[model samples]
Target: MPPPGTFTILLFGPAQDRAGSGQVTVQARVECTCGELLRALGEQHPALAFALPAARLAVNHALVAPDHRPRPDDEIALIALVDGG
Candidate 1:
């Protein structure tokens, strides 16, 4: 499990391209919600701002809504939306 007030962040596909990394950790209050995480990521990493709101927040491999609150040890991931013809 990660340290208190921190959560693992997994970035996939376009999110990875934007973040320049596939994995990261975010520090926040224990009550942090998915939307808060999304906003924090965008504020901290400008490159990811455009893709953040559209990205999917997943915990423990399950997709979650923006309002979903993350728990300790939960595997957090951001799956970017993709579009192709």
Candidate 2:
């Protein structure tokens, strides 16, 4: 199990490629907003820095705004824009 205040963020598409994995664990306060979480991810994974601005955060299968607060138990996923036809 992850330590308290740690969140396992699921990665998709370019996010997974940049992160070099399907998921990542981030440490944050229990009441952190999605915006804060995004910042943390970028700081922890420099490869994701450039792609993060265009990414959207999903909490518990639902797209949330930057101000949305996420709980420890909530499922978090980072959705980056995909390019293709």
Candidate 3:
């Protein structure tokens, strides 16, 4: 089992395109904020950084505040909003 206070993040849609498919597990030492995680993900995937500023982040299937903190085993999903009416 993973160490205490650790969680896995799943990237989907444009976010997946940015962070790549598969799973990225982060340790507890890292701050579990949605925005900070997105920034780290963007760094890992430069394509994400290209347009990360406008991307939306979610935790546990719920839309969250910018400073939302993820709990252990929380599933984080990064979604890129499409602006096409």
Best candidate per lDDT, number? 2
Question: How far out, in Å, is residue 63 in model 1?
Answer: 1.2
Clash pairs of candidate 1? none
Across 11-83, the per-residue lDDT of candidate 3 in tens digits comes to 6566566556655655544456776667666665566566567776667788788788777567676666565
Of candidates 3 and 1, the better by TM-score = 1
Model 2 residue 35 CA deviation in Å = 0.4
Which sections of candidate 2 miss by over 4 Å? none
Per-residue accuracy of model 1 over 1-85 as CA lDDT, tens digit each: 5678787788877778767899777777889899888877777678877787668788898989888999858888887777768
Off by over 4 Å in 3: 3-7, 18-22, 25-30, 83-85
**Candidate lDDT (C-alpha), each:** 0.80, 0.87, 0.66
lDDT of 2 by residue, 43-62 (tens): 88888887787887899999
User: Against the true structure, what is every candidate's RMSD?
Assistant: 1.9, 1.4, 3.0
User: Following a full C-alpha superposition, what root-mean-square deviation does model 3 have from the true structure?
Assistant: 3.0
Candidate 2 vs. true structure, TM-score: 0.90
Q: Each candidate's TM vs. the true structure? A: 0.82, 0.90, 0.66
Query: Which residue runs does candidate 1 get wrong by more than 4 Å?
Result: 83-85
lDDT of predicted model 2? 0.87
